[model samples]
Target: MSAPTYIYKLVSFSSPVPDPLPEKLPLSELDVASGFIHMSTPLQVPRTLKRFFAEDPRIYILRVKYSTVEKNIKWEDSKGEVPGEVGAEGMFAHIYNRGLGTTEIESVAIWERNRDWDEPLKKAESWLVY
Candidate 1:
């Protein structure tokens, strides 16, 4: 099978950088506590946002392509560790870069309430593969 072209990371709208994301994304509190970078497939993003993101105003979705971090990324069982749908018993992508690790940024889009989550959601839905 061909390798996955992309994976997704959700960041707060108020990111560290003025841009949507920084050179290396800062891990969430949960990621820091668990010692892994939690990622989602297109299928997982919507539910992940609903379950964990709650009613936040500005959520940024990071589109990370495989070429960006091919060696560093691994698909492993989330093992019910993540808080949302990703926590279910299924393999999820974990970018194993500790602090400010290597991950190529393909593109970034915002997900705000009453705004443009639909197109991104549809795009993300296309990335689902087991």
Candidate 2:
């Protein structure tokens, strides 16, 4: 049987680079803007991502949100975790299992299946590209 597929949503913010800035400027000091929401599946997960979660032994449900400042991006999480701090770009909820190792994550639903949010996640890749 084929293994189940898993999908994750990632969001980021971006803005044009600004003019010269003072030394020791923090990210908060720059302009930021909402980028976009992207959907990713296990098949598409990068090697870096796999290495990052190698020892975690838990699957995750990630939700991401962002806003723009002058030209920098500010991130937040609906799950109460600090946004943009987890390395990857998004908010996440960890789903764990006691003895089954890790819970299998199937496909994720953002807009096509569910429309809970105003913005829906775009597919990781377009079929036309293939």
Candidate 3:
């Protein structure tokens, strides 16, 4: 299959993403430590959240155009503790040498941690560029 047109960045609700969004987004602790930004494909967002951000009360799923960050992105093997979890093709997108910027973002959708989780998952699916 062809690469997705877009990728998703999950931001903690604690970090306020401005209404107009900013040129550069603050890196998550994991991102800072890892030296690259973690991102997921459209179909990978829900599982990513469940695995990594399950404790977060809310999350901001930033829809970003793949073209904008294509040069900086590396399709690397699963680097997390658990191998292959939430990884598509056993690889995930990792952005290096720069932070995620506003120019790439198409939209931002808020997903709260709901009891069933399905509602938020559906909302996230709807926000994806497909």
lDDT of 1 by residue, 12-113 (tens): 655533363455656788788767777877656777777777666768776777566667666676642443222244667787764333347666666666
TM-score order of candidates, top first: 3, 1, 2
Best by lDDT: 3
- Residue 3 error for model 2, in Å? 19
TM-score of each: 0.69, 0.20, 0.86
Q: Indicate which candidate wins on TM-score.
A: 3
Query: Given candidate 3, what's the lDDT at residue 65?
Result: 86
- Against the unseen true structure, what C-alpha lDDT does each candidate score? 0.63, 0.27, 0.77
The parts of candidate 2 lying over 4 Å away from their true place are: 1-6, 10-34, 46-49, 61-130
Ranking of predictions according to lDDT: 3, 1, 2
Scored against the true structure, residue 94 in model 1 reaches a CA lDDT of: 80
| Pairs of colliding residues, candidate 3 | none
Using alpha carbons, what is the TM-score of model 1?
A: 0.69
RMSD of each: 4.9, 17.6, 3.1
Which stretches of candidate 3 lie above 4 Å from their native place?
80-88
| 2 versus 3: better TM-score goes to | 3
Task: Write model 3 residue lDDT over 1-130, tens digit each, in one string.
Answer: 5678889898887886788888887888889898888888877776788887888888888888888888887777647333342235767888889887678888888777877456788765556764
Considering TM-score, which of the candidate structures 1 and 3 is the better prediction for this target?
3
